[model samples]
Each structure stands twice: as C-alpha cells, then as structure tokens.
Target: MKNAISIAMMALFSLCCAAQNISVQSINYPTRYLRHSDSKGYLGEMLSDLDRQDASFKLVNAGIPDCPNCIRFESVNYPGQYLRHSNYLIWLSALSSDLDYKDASFRLVQGLAGTDRVQRTTHADVFR
Candidate 1:
C-alpha cells in the first residue's frame, strides 16, 4: 500500500513537470484538492480526481462557452497513460505561448502608462 501511494504521487508530480519550459519545483497539484479555474490562465482536465481519497474538482466556470468540442479528461489507473498524449501536450504548449504573449502585451501597456501593473500570473498548464 505504501509503495502504491508513493508511485501514484510520483505520477502526479510527473504530470506537473510535463508543462512546457517548466522549471524544477516541488509538484503539489494533487487532484484531490484542486479547485476549478477558468481564468484563461488555467488548464488541465475539467475534472481533477474521482478517487475517494480526495474531493473531485470540477471547473469553476459559471457557464460554458459555445465551444464545439469541450476538452474532457479521465484519470487513469496507470501512470504512463496519465501523462503521455501528444495532442494534449501540444495544446498545453500553445496555451503557454499564448499566455506569455498576453502577459508581455499587458506589461507593455502598463509600462507606458506609468501605472503599477497588477499581475495576472498563472501557471503553465501541466497538460502541455
């Protein structure tokens, strides 16, 4: 039981590390405690974890946009499948690039106005 728990946690850490251009850091996005976010900066499966050990997290968005194909995710019992999808990771990388561009643009705008910019920082979605 102890080894299994350790392995599961390790898999979770790897998922966090899968973010593009990610820096080495303590991975702590436990699916059990994740709260939903749709702040444009948030990503990953709409649902966090379904296991009884933790609460299941769903997106916090009040309303769904008219997007045709909403992204969905199902947690896997296996570690390998939990973090190895090309298209999913590719989408995450694109989201990261988009966030970088958006942040820079906002900073430039604030700098010219001589105003202290409010930071809208977000993590690079680990799905990438």
Candidate 2:
C-alpha cells in the first residue's frame, strides 16, 4: 500500500511540474520562414505536399518586410569603397535583399497552384 501511495504522489508531482511551463522569451516579432528556391524546377515540386491532410499549408501576406525596413534600394547612396558589397552588412545593419526575392518566388508559386492549402488572392482582392 505504501509503494502505491508513493507512486501516485510522484505522478501528481510530475503533473504539477508539467503544468508550470517556463516561457523564456523577452519579445516576439511577426516573422515567417518561407522556403527559398532559386530554381524554376523546385517551384512545381513545392506544391506536391499540400494535400488536404496537411495542416501547415502555404500562405502569403503582403506588407512591409520585418527587416531592411521600408527604404527603397535605389535611393540609398551606398559608398562602394570602405562599405563595399562585402562590407555592406556592417554599414547598414541588416540587409535581407536575397531573402526578399528568393522566398517571395516560392510563396508566389505556392499561391499560383490553387490548392486546398493556399489562401487565394486575385487582383481585385489586392486592391482592397
């Protein structure tokens, strides 16, 4: 009887500990990790997994990027000497130019496929 009582108390202690989840986050930013694909061949292949059973379907939301801010690329007066293309990262802080194009293409092709996965957007829908 004592052994069974001890086991039950141990199980109860574990359950209480599990209930107290430790959240070690200071801040949360709205960010997404879209698959980046440079090849046209991969575009068609990305859609094959978006069946009805899959809950994590493709999605696209058009808004200002979280990084590289709202500054237009052409407007920036980039000094090509000390801050050469190699040293650009240290100068302007964060530059996500490659991610802007590469990830977008993957997300777009996902939209084009019109699966049970993608939330469809038409030209009309974009205007509103």
Candidate 3:
C-alpha cells in the first residue's frame, strides 16, 4: 500500500511539472501564438498538431550563469534550441556563446496594459 501511494504521488508530480509548458500568444491577435518556422519566430494560428507543438515552450532558468533572475524560453519540440533575438528579429537557435545566452534571457514583467498580461523584457544591462 505504501509503495502504491508513492508511485501515485510520483505520477501526480510529473503531471504538475509537465503543466509548466506554456504557449505565448499575441496580445492583439489572441488567436495567434508564437511559433518557429525555418528557425525564425513568428505569430501564427494553431490549426494543427504541429502548429501547437511549435507554439509550446518551456520556461527554463537563464542559460547565463550571472543572470539568476532572468528566464529563457526553450522550444518544446527542439529541446536544445531556445528563443533568442538577433539583428532585431527573434529566432530559435542553440546556445553557442555568451551572446546567445544573453539574447535568450529575458525578465518577465507585468504588461504595460495590465497585470493580466505578462511581458518578456530583455535584460537592458546585458544588451547595452
């Protein structure tokens, strides 16, 4: 009975952890979600299973060791790849250098419009 209870608890914990996966949606276009295609990030409507998978991401700790408060968005389908911006455009890329880590890390703040929405703001200090 104790072993069964332990197993059930472990299963519940796994489900709770899996629930951390999130889909980033556009504020203006609620029907559209952030997705990567051809390594580029764009907003698209989730019409198929592939679309949904592309839209899904896991919020992980920042890849940079110095940025403890920052978070990085890791692609659900592409485990090692993370959401990053380069040349003022978002892309799904693998971390290779400090610049890549900095580009991927973002601080989550309350949206300017309201608290109901969350905004991912780049770490200005690192960028500048």
Candidate 4:
C-alpha cells in the first residue's frame, strides 16, 4: 500500500511539471514553430530533431519582482536563456538586469483572431 501511494504521488507530480513545457507555434503557419538560433527568435519549420529541441520552452513565472501574474519563456535547450524583446525584435538571452526581466516578462491573452489560441503581450507593449 505504501509503494502504490508513492507511485501515484510521483505520477501526479510528473504531470504537473510536464504541463509547463510547451512549443510556441505560429497561427498563420501552423507547421512553423518559434525557435532560437544565433540568439534570435524566428518562426521556422521543425526539419530536424535539434529544431524540435530548439523550439521547446518551459513556461515559467516572470523573473520580475512586481509581476507575479506574468510569465516568461525559458529555452529548454539553452537552460538559462529566455525569450526577450529588444529593439522590436525577439531574442533568446541570459537575463541579468531589471530591464532584462521586464523584457522577458509577458502576459498570455486570448488570441486577437480567435479564442482558441493564445497571444503573448510584452511588458513594454512592443510585441504582440
């Protein structure tokens, strides 16, 4: 009975962790997914196994102090790197400063086109 209870608890914890892992896909181009290469973010097709890994990200709580409701996308492959917008362009970078935290933080809202999808809005209001 003890072993069975432990196994069930472990399985529940695994499911919760897995729920936070995701791949951002483009609505217009469903076959393309958001990926990072050369520290730049791009919507590209998953042509190889590495591409799939590059596209995967863990949805984590915002790194900023004030925004507990916001979220950040941490690259699964790169570990410490997160998706951040700079100069109107998105890039995968290692966050260090308050500015970096703000840049990386985003809110997930209902898609403008439809409710079936989600849209990411940046704290700077620069990217949608």
Candidate 5:
C-alpha cells in the first residue's frame, strides 16, 4: 500500500512538472524576464520586464512522444495561445498545424546552481 501511494504521488509530481508556470529570465540581463508587449500582435513584440506577472508563463507539453523535451508556453493571463518566436522575438500565437515552422516549441532547462534563471530553446535550436 505504501509503495502504491508513493507511485501515485510521483505521478502527480510529474504531471505538475509537465504543465508548470515558469519565468524565463535573460541570462545576459539577469534582472530582466522575458515578456510580451501589452499589444496583442506578432513580430517585434518581444521584450523583457522586471515584473513577475508579466513574465510568468505556463509551460506545457507539445504532445509529441518522440521528442519528450519539445514543449510550448502559454500565457497565464491569455488562453488558447502559445508562445512563439517571430523575427528573433517572442510573441503569443494561436495554435497552427505547421509545428515545424510556427516556432511555438521550446525546451526548458535549468540554469547554473543558486540562480533563478531558466533558459528556453525553440525547435530551431535557438535560445531565447
């Protein structure tokens, strides 16, 4: 019974990690957090902010079993949209069939020890 309960708890923890809210921070500018502009548009709208609410994003799985690390980020305040990089900038975009080109996929990685930085890498293998 104890082992079964432990397994269930572990599964729950994994599920939480699969759809966790994370803040993307700039490694270069440690004080800044990745953020989308107030305007709801694509391209040239990526920026950084010091506010946590503006920086928070829900990181969810892209549902590709082959690529376990492939994931998408959704805004906590906005629904039905995912984070994508356009023109080397970040923006929230609706779901698209062209997953390869939509640039909506990313991989979350831990930064150095004792730091609050999280790195997001797109499917193109570009870091943001």
Candidate 6:
C-alpha cells in the first residue's frame, strides 16, 4: 500500500510539472492567439492571430546567466525556434549564436487587467 501511494504521488507531481507550460495570448484581441501563419519558417514570417491549435506556445527560460526574468516563447509544435519580434510583429526564429535577437526575450507580468498576465518585451519594454 505504501509503495502504491509513493508511485501515485510521483505520477501526480510529473503531471503537475507538465501542466505548467505557458502560452502567449493577445490581451487586445482575446479570441486571437500569437502564432506563425507562414509556409516557410524563416525570418519575417507572418506573425498573426489564429483561433485554433497552433497559437499555443511554451514560455521557456531564456537560459541567460544574467537575466532571470527573461523568457523565450517556444512553439508547442516547433520546439527549435523561438517567438521573436521585429518591426512591431512577432514570429519564430532559432536561437542564434550571437543572440542578437534578444528582442524575443520578454518578462511575464501582470497585464492591464488585474487578474490577466502579459508578456512584456525586455528590449522595448512593451506589452504584447
């Protein structure tokens, strides 16, 4: 009985951890979600809103030694590239060596609405 309880507890813990994956949703457009709508996953891809599945993303730790608050948005479907912003638009791109695209890094904070949360860009310091 004790062994069974331990196994059940461990399984519960793993499920709780996996449930923590975060997503970036539009505050202005509540029905729309941030995602890639382009055929080619290249730079300057169509960063638009969608009503369905591809919109969800995982908020990953940027892994920067100095920046603890910084985070990278990794797609639930495409794990390699991260959600990047350029020209006031958001798209996915791979983590390059120089890391010049730190604009992609954002801090999740209390949004305009009291209970809601927002992904504020670290570079421009604007809510998305």
State which candidate has the highest TM-score.
3
Best by lDDT: 3
Clashes of 2: 0
lDDT of 5 by residue, 1-128 (tens): 34443453344336536755766556566666666556242222234342455566776667655556667767776766777777766667677667533478775444443234334466564322
Q: Model 5 misses residue 3 by how many Å?
A: 26
Order the numbered candidates by lDDT, best leading. 3, 4, 5, 6, 1, 2
lDDT of 5: 0.57
Q: What's the ranking of the predictions by TM-score, best on top?
A: 3, 4, 6, 5, 1, 2
lDDT of 4 by residue, 49-98 (tens): 99999999987776455544367888989999999999989999999997
Taking the tens digit of each residue's C-alpha lDDT, what string does model 2 give over 12-127? 33433242311111112213222212211111222333311121212222243442111111101221111102211211112356443322321111222233122211221222
Q: Is candidate 1 or candidate 4 better by lDDT?
A: 4
Q: Which of the two candidates, 2 or 3, achieves a greater TM-score against the reference?
A: 3
- On residues 57-125, what C-alpha lDDT tens digit does candidate 3 reach at each position? 987766455555467888999999999989888999999998888889887655665645567778858
**lDDT-superior candidate, 4 or 6:** 4
State candidate 4's TM-score: 0.78
Tens-place lDDT digits, model 6, residues 43-112: 2222443423356566666656555556666666767777776666666777675443576776544445
lDDT of 1 at 83: 15
Error of 2 at 27 (Å): 43
Query: Which of the predicted structures, 1 or 6, would earn the higher TM-score when compared with the native?
Result: 6
Clashing pairs in 1: none
Runs of candidate 2 with Cα error greater than 4 angstroms are 1-56, 65-128
Candidate 2: global Cα-lDDT? 0.23
Question: What local lDDT score does residue 1 receive in model 3, on the 0 to 100 scale?
Answer: 39
The RMSD of every model to the true structure, in order and in angstroms, is: 16.7, 20.1, 8.4, 8.3, 7.9, 9.7
lDDT for residue 78 in candidate 6, whole number 0-100: 69
TM-score of 1: 0.18
